[model samples]
Structures are given as structure tokens and as C-alpha cells.
Target: MRIFLFSILLLLAGCSQTLHINERYSASGQNSRVQYIVLHYTSADLNRSLQLLTETEVSSHYLIGDRTPTIYRLVDENRRAWHAGDSQWQGRTWLNGTTIGIELVNQGFYDTPTGRYWQPFAPAQIEALIGLLKDIMQRHQLPPGSILAHSDIAPQRKVDPGPLFPWKQLADAGLVPWPDADAVARQQALFSASLPTVQWFQAQLMRQGYAVPLHGELDQATRNVLAAFQMKYRPARYDGEPDAQTA
Candidate 1:
């Protein structure tokens, strides 16, 4: 009986071993594991949104509901969430490893006889989102311009958090960057005089952190990416064709 008890104790100890490590120093040359925040709109109500994000194969770090504008932390920030599937940003692919995703409950868009109609976000929802964004940015020590729309990172397939998302409000809140009207007007004048070549547009888009092709052709994929940028910066029109304004 003594020997059996000793063996059981040994097994228990093996199962519950702990490790101790030194914490005398910190590194100054390293940056944060999280580099970007991707925003999305869940095309469902609160209950369906909860079901999709929590009980399915998809998930995000946070979800903002529209009815009460409640913020839900579906997943912890210390762990990876499956929100950004097959996503890329600024030359970094597979953004799920390095991005925090926030989904807002919305109906997204629908088509009518005239054209497509997008659902506008409520003031309360936007307010709640701004508060949540500030908290996340502060806690993660993220810099300005670290937020991106789902289409911005995955333009080829996704377009949630669409054009009516009030990006200017975010810029005003210092959460993202806004273009200088003077600089854009100057460039627009130059482009008006002589528009840039397709290759030039491709190069510029690549520099803007999109994964565009450099083949100098106005292909569909390139146009899709351009449309993504246009929707964010110039919501008046975004037909995916290069224009003086787009330039």
C-alpha cells in the first residue's frame, strides 16, 4: 500500500510540474505582436451575430451591437482569433496572427430596382465603437493609421464595414490618417494635366500597402483593390477605374 501511494504521488507530481524563469531584463528592440486593427460588419442581428462569432468556426476579438450598442468581447486579446481569414495588409499575409478584429452588428447592404442600398450605422453604435477603439489602441500601444477595413486588407473578396462607415470621424478622433486636401488637389491637378500610366498607378497602390499586381494592366484584381481605397477615401464614387481623383 505504501509503494502504491508513492507511485500515485509521483504520477500526480509529473502531471502538475511548474517551471520558473528569470525576468531580470526586457528588450527595447522588439515591437508589439499586434500591428493592425481590422474592422468588419456582421450582416446579422445581435443574436445571429453572437451565434456566428461565438458558436461557429469564425470569431473576432470584439463585436459591437447596434440595438443597444453594447460591446462584447468574444475572444481574449492575448490569444489569436479567427476573424481575419486569408487576409493580408502592408505586405503581411495571414493577418489573423497579428491583427485584432472588431465586428459591428449591421445588415450590410441590399439591392433595389434603382441601385444597392447600404444600411447606415446608428449614432450610438458609432459612439460605442469609438470608445472601444480608443480603449484597444491605448491598451495595445498602437499608433495612428493602424486601423483598416476588412476590404482594405482583403479587397479581392470582402467589402464589409463599407463606404458609409464614417472614416472621417475616425480620422478626427485620431484613430486613422486622413489625406491633406491641399496635397490631394495638387496631385489631382498634375494627374489631370497628364494622367499616370497603369504601371504608375500599380506602383503607387503597392506603396500604399496593397497587394496589387505590377503587370501594368488594368486588370480586375487591380481595379478591385483600387475600389477598396476609393471607397475608404472618396465615397462619392468608386468604380474601380483610375481617375485624376483616384490618382
Candidate 2:
């Protein structure tokens, strides 16, 4: 009986060493793991999109269909998705670990005489997306600025949810930020006479959450990042030129 009691005490002592018991509770500061919601275009049809997002390596938290107004919840919000690959945003890198990616089923774009023509998202599809965004943001306590484009995070390699996307509509709905027309106009006028230097443009791009190279030269990488920004804001034309409108 004494041996049994001694063995039990030894086991209890070993367990205590590995366990921590704290009963104090405070409801003060709190935050969620989710920080950003990145949007993308599947660039494939609905069936193909479902296949790629499911059977293949690529995945997303949600996918809005092109034809049907169905919002497929491919991955749970609490889990990570393999959507944003090698991405960075506002000094944060490898966004796949920290962001919720939503893929929209659209054909992306094709070049034409007028310009690069990107397929417009269906109204119902966008409505569904807005609803999903509202729910996710509300649950995660995410701000409007957290809503971002996949292109915005991976400028060097991506430009999906492309220029034809109705960013203003989302902005109006308070889902994301949009530049004030008056402010943009004033800046355009100021920069029209002489566009800002490459360094200045790079600085502004960084301020807008793009990871641009501050080489003071308009290199290809810088141009790609600028084009991604223009594609989101001033989609009318994005020749990667640092012009008044682009600024």
C-alpha cells in the first residue's frame, strides 16, 4: 500500500512539472488571427475553378461562381489557404499564412484595339461576395483597409480580379478604401506639368501598401508594381508609366 502511494505521488509530481494551471481571466485587449482578405480571379470557368481550387494544389477560403450565384466555402475561415503564394502586403510577407483568400470565377482578360478587355463580374456574384466579406470582416473584426486584391499583394507575379472588377462599388459599400476624386484631381494637376520622379512614385506606392523597389530607377519590377496599382485604381490605362493619372 505504501509503495502504491509513493508511485502515485511520483506520477503526480511529474505531471505537475509539465502542466500549468492559471485561473485568472481578464476581458481587455483582444485580436483575431485574420488580418487581410485577399480577392482573386480564378481565370477559369466555374467547373474548372472548382476543380483547381479543390483537387489541385491551389485553394481558397471561398469561391464565387461565374454563372451561378453560389459562394462555395472551400476552406474554413479558421484554416489557411494556398491562394496567396509568395505574397507581401504592407511589410507583411507570405500572406497565405495570415490572409483569407476569396477566388472569383472569371476569365481574366484579353487584349484588344481599345485596350485589355477583362470580363466583368456578374452582379449576383459580386453581391454574394459582398455578403461573404461582410460576414468575415465582422467575425474577424477586420477593417476596410484589410480588404485587398491578390494582385495588390503579389504584384510581381499576379494581376487577377483585374481592372474590370468593380472596386468602386465595394468601396462605396465600405468594404475597401478608394481615393477621393477631389484629392486625386488636385494631385493630378500638380503632377501633370511634370510627373514625379521614379523615387517619388516608389515612395507613394509603398505608402499605398505596395512592396516596390526603391531603386530610384523605373525598373521592370517597379513598373510591374505600378501597373498592379493602376489596374486597381486607374484601370483606364496602365502602361506602367508614372503619369499624372497613375499618380
Candidate 3:
């Protein structure tokens, strides 16, 4: 009887040790570390997108397919994804640490005799993305403003989720805020008389969450940022020129 009891005690102790190693106590009122949702275009079809995002160094948390569309979660939300390379937003830099990336299977753009023409995302794909966005936002308690475009964060080197992206649809779904048309029209008129100086444009761009140089010069860097902004807000024309409409 004594030897049997000793074996039982040893088994219980081992079980307790395993439990201690596997389980942890936690406090309440804590949330996920996810702070932002960055959208991108895969620039490839379903098979190619899966191949690149899954097997390559670049990856996103989710990928929305095109035809026969569905949202494929490539990376777990708790883990950091390799998207958003050399990126920034507001005052934060290196956004991959804090953002969840969602890539849509898209052709991105094709050059034409007129200009570069960007392809539009499929309606079904966008719908799937909206549902995924809602789930992520609800779980993370993120606001509409936290949803961003890849181009918005990395203006100089990246332009995925380009002009044809349906930002207005997200805005309509209350997932993102859109610039007031009335206000833009008023500002456009005001600036038309005399376009703001390059310094003012830089300041406004910075205020609007773009990381542009404040050197008061329309250099290549400044043009790149302006083009990025126009790609999001004024997609009809993003010539990188500081005109009244873009101002």
C-alpha cells in the first residue's frame, strides 16, 4: 500500500509540473497589441499571391482572393507579419510591429499609351475584406481612422492599394473617415486664387499624416509624397504636381 501511494504521489506531482509549465494566470482589461490595419494589393493572381505571400519573405495577416474570392488568413493575428516594410504612420515608424496587413489579390496596374491605369478590386473581394475588417476592428477595438493604405505609410517606395482602391466604400461602411467634399471644394477654391507655398503644402501634408519633408522645396521626395496623397484622395489625377485641387 505504501509503494502504491508513493507512485500515485509521483504521478500527481508530474502532472502538476506539466500544468504549471503550460498554464498562466492573467489579468483583465488588457487588449490586443494590434494598433492599425494596413491594406495592400497583391499585384498577382490567386496562385501567385499565395506563392509569394506564403513562401516568400513578404507576408500579410490575410489575403482576399479575386475570382472565386475568399479571405485566406496567412498569418496569425498575434504574430507579427512581414508586411509593411520600411513604413511609418503619424509619428510611428517601422509599422510591421504594430499593424495587421490585408492583401487583396489584384493586378495592381498596367502602363498605357495615355498613362498608368490601375485595376479595380472585385466587389466580392471587397465584401470579404469588409467582413474581415469588422471582425479585426471589433476584436482589437480599433477605430476607423486606424485603417490605412500601404501607400499611405510608405509613400516613397510603395504604392500598393493604389488609386482605384475603394476607400469611399470603407468610409461609407463607417470603417474609415472620408474628407468632406464641401470642405475640399471650399479649400480648393481658396487655393485656386493662389496656391499655397511649398512650405505650407509640406505642413499640410504632415498634418494629414504624411511623412513629407518640410524643407519648403518641391523636390523629388516632396513630389512622391504628394503623388501618394493624390493617389488616395484625388485618384483621377496624381501627377505629383502641387495644384489647387491637390492642395
Top lDDT prediction, candidate number: 1
> In candidate 1, which residue pairs get closer than 3 Å at backbone N, Cα or C atoms, i.e. clash?
none
Please give, for residues 97-144, the per-residue lDDT of candidate 3 as tens digits.
999999999999989999787888889988898999999999999988
Greater-lDDT candidate between 1 and 2: 1
Candidate 1 residue 8 Cα shift, in angstroms, is 7.1
The parts of candidate 1 lying over 4 Å away from their true place are 1-11
True lDDT of residue 233, candidate 1? 96
lDDT of 3 at 213: 94
Candidate 1 on 168-242: residue-level lDDT in tens? 999998998999999999999999999999999989988888889999999999999999999999988988999
Clashing pairs in 3: none
Please give the lDDT score at residue 80 for candidate 2.
91
The TM-score between candidate 2 and the true structure equals 0.87
What value does the lDDT take at residue 184 in candidate 3? 89
In model 2, what is the error at residue 160, expressed in angstroms?
Answer: 0.4
Report the Cα RMSD per candidate: 2.2, 4.2, 4.8
lDDT by residue (tens digit), candidate 2, 28-121: 7868889999999998999999999999889999999978979899998889999999999899999888999999999998899996677999
Shift in Å, residue 222, candidate 1: 0.5
TM-score of each: 0.93, 0.87, 0.88
